[model samples]
Target: MKMIDLTGTTGVIFGVANHRSLAWAIAEQLGQAGARLAFSYQGERLKENVAMLAAKLPGSIIFECDVTDDDAMARGFAEIGTAFGHLDYLVHSVAFARKEDLEGTFRDTSRDGYRLALEISAYSLLPMARLAAP
Candidate 1:
């Protein structure tokens, strides 16, 4: 059998909420390709979820990181670098929207709600990229 070589490749997956998440799916594919895994979660609740999901992927490192916090994001990436020295790929599946915003019309969305959604769903990716960039 021919195997894909990922001998030195390291992958960091951000925003894995549960087993059914897109992040989890990507992590699975990366694992299949022999990439080492590191995972980040938003909070304590999600930290537990990520840890559970990561257990199936051997040698995976899981960390708590809220993308909205620059310090937390920086520390997370720094920790990953400390652990792995270098990284080859970073997968971002982070997105957020309030339940009301998702269910109701855009006209009904409050200004704060819109800002929150954009900040979490769209803007978070920029810093994540900057910090994780090789």
Candidate 2:
């Protein structure tokens, strides 16, 4: 198949947890397409893994961006903008639910747990879109 020529395009990817992550696969495809990439990991624990994968792609960079924190997301997008000058796209492949919350029926999930799941899984995209917009 002819590779999509993404030369000169720039993008940020969120949720590359490890080499096996679907996000990592997407990043690899984007890299192969010639798009420059920046990866955002949720916490320090994930930083090393993301950095390692990003290093394999020329000109790729990684940043810490906990989606639960607005400040961190803002800073991360700012860093991406500064690094790439512009964004052509963004890939969001992150989602989370507490272990306990996942164990029981949906009705058994606590209010806080439900809120946390939605905040991380769904609501995060809104701020990310707004920040990445500019």
lDDT of each: 0.86, 0.92
Backbone N/Cα/C clashes per model: 0, 0
Candidate 1, poorest ten consecutive residues by summed lDDT: 1-10
| TM-score of decoy 2 | 0.94
Any runs in candidate 2 off by more than 4 Å, and if so which? none
Clash pairs (backbone) in predicted model 1: none
Residue 52 alpha-carbon offset, candidate 2, angstroms? 0.7
The residue-by-residue lDDT of candidate 2 on 95-129, one tens digit each, is 89999999969899999999999999899999989
| Top lDDT hit | 2
What TM-score does each of the candidates earn?
0.92, 0.94
RMSD for each of the candidates: 1.5, 1.2
As for model 2, its CA RMSD to the true structure in angstroms is 1.2
**lDDT (C-alpha) at residue 55 in model 2:** 97
* Tens digits of per-residue lDDT for model 1, 1-134: 32676756898998789989998998987877777889998877777888988888877898888887999989999989988888888887888988888787889988888999888888988998898887
